[model samples]
Target: MVLAELGFDAGQILAGLKPWVECESPTYDAAAVDRMMDLATYDLVAAGATIERIPGRMGFGGSVRATFPHKSAGEPGILISGHLDTVHPVGTLDVLPWRIDGNKCFGPGVMDMKAGNYLAIEAVRKLALAGHETPLPVTVLFTPDEEVGTPSTRELIEMEARKNKYVLVPEPASADGGAVTGRYAIARFHLKAKGKPSHASWALEDGRSAIAAMARKILQIEALTTPDCTFSVGVVKGGQWVNCVSSLCEAEVLSMAKRQADLDDGVERMLALSEEAGGVVFEVTQSVTRPVWEPSSETLAMYDLARDVAKEIGFDLTHGSAGGGSDGNFTGAMGIPTLDSIGVRGHGLHTLDEHIYIDSLVERAQLMAGMLMRLA
Candidate 1:
């Protein structure tokens, strides 16, 4: 294929990826994420793409839509999906500054997605520069709130994907150096406890401690974890004074299940805990959710295409279902023939030590370019 011979420049690719890692776009900070989106807009427009900026809703940053020029312009083609937001906060750069040590390049969000998004953009740009149009039209959609389960932009993602023939997500490559063909069901919940407050020492019998109720409930939630379904109370906040019974407490729960039915049962049991227990009222509310996306035959065919492309690029590619949820969860669930996690290979995701293998930049770009050229 013409794209396989494009020969992406690794130095130039790193140059393009550095500023993005330095930008530090956390999911909760709309302005920081917008800055990242602005950078993407500039790059995509420069690559001869038509740009559309969708304003952020629900207190999240806006998303970018870039459509590459092609003869089959508006027909069903490829939808390349990604997220610009990272779990790292804005000031993370001060701690985990961008650096290159040997074959590894270290920075916040470098591997989790910045490098992946940049690689896809670079592949498209190289094809454009070489005066070769893709076999099918291409549209790249970068959202700003994926780390928080794509709460703000799920509707937009599904709408754009429906108009396309296939969906490709450049989330970080799987741990086993493979791509994602399917994703597990994921659900997040918020729990609250309300109790009467009183002096700890003087009126112990009169007090109803919200923290005590939440502690017991936390144990209950954790005990529900099975091989098929697992639960975790990751965040908790409660208490006012050391000598007084706590009046209120709140916790965030995350659940992951291999199947939709397992997740549904888990959700049902979680909701059952909303009743009053031990004189304290508990509330369970479902937050952001991602439905299960099992691999279909069409998705398997897409993976076969990717594997063939990888073989031509001098590497064997593998595919499997992953636990962590991504925008692919939304697209694949729609039966859109989605191929996901076709991005840079790296480790330490969602941590300070996050980084990518510098060599994978060009290799993955070539793989992506091949897929773009070969996909009809």
Candidate 2:
């Protein structure tokens, strides 16, 4: 394989990726994510790429934009995109410690993304070391808040993507070693339930508990799930003291739909949920949203390029629309040709057992290098 000819070393790649996996960059922790950005910046600099850092906004960590030097610099080229944040919070390493068992390597964000991002970095680094210039200039954008639907970075993502000819997302490859051509539309909502506070022992009957009201709202939100649109409550916070009746409760809700119209209807229904139950008022506010990206002819053509690369690398690549949303959603929805989930192959995403196959390191790196060299 060309990876072998290029001296791609799985051991070296895994060693280099260990620090990223151990970084523990949960989306909400700006400091942790910034540390990750710092790490990536250091690598890009060593790869001889010019670096631009955009400080975080909307209470999120900053983003990194690295541009490789080429004769076609300042022209439309390939945009290599990914995120530094993982859904697993800090200290998840205690349970999902980095370990290599058989062909699988385990860590908090190994499969979901850290490995893929590292692969992109390594591909550029190695290609530079080999003195090979890609047919087009390459730019890298690493965001810090994709885990929360990219509330702060969506506009930045789209803006940077608009300057590129194509976008390659290093999200985790599918279970069947496939790529992502389309993504479901996703919406987020903030829910609040308010009630009268009183002494629980003396006026429990007189006071309406917001926690109880929130519980009822959760059930209602769950019942909104269907074959077309699915809703779930992911975060909830309520009472502060046991002796007092809770006056306020809050929750974060997420909804996903295969079609834009279904997601629109779901958002309407979610916002229409304002009501008062026994003096406890329930209110919902829409938050960040990801528009549905149906596979366009351009996107399918990009996937074909990826498939051809995989075949040359001695593997078969398949692609389909997936449920989870990535930064690809923004680029694809904007009608930019995008190939996503073109990272390492693995499973157990967003779980304690998240990991990647050990051998996929060089294979994916080869595919990335091929795309960089072949895309014009």
Candidate 1 lDDT over 1-376, as tens digits, reads 5445797988999998888989889999999999999999999998888999999999999999999989999999999999999999878889899999999999999988999999999999998888878889999999999999998899999999999999999988988779999999999999999999999999988999999999999999999999999999999999979899999999999999999999999999998889886789999999988999999999999999999889888898899999999999999999999999999999998999999998888889998898998899
Let me know the TM-score candidate 1 reaches against the reference structure.
0.97
lDDT of 2 by residue, 274-353 (tens): 88879999999999999999999989998888889889889999999998899999999999999999999998999998
lDDT of each: 0.93, 0.93
Clashing pairs in 1: none
Q: The CA-based lDDT of model 2 is what?
A: 0.93
For candidate 1, the 10 contiguous residues with the lowest summed lDDT are: 1-10
Q: Which stretches of candidate 1 lie over 4 Å from their true place?
A: 2-4, 201-205
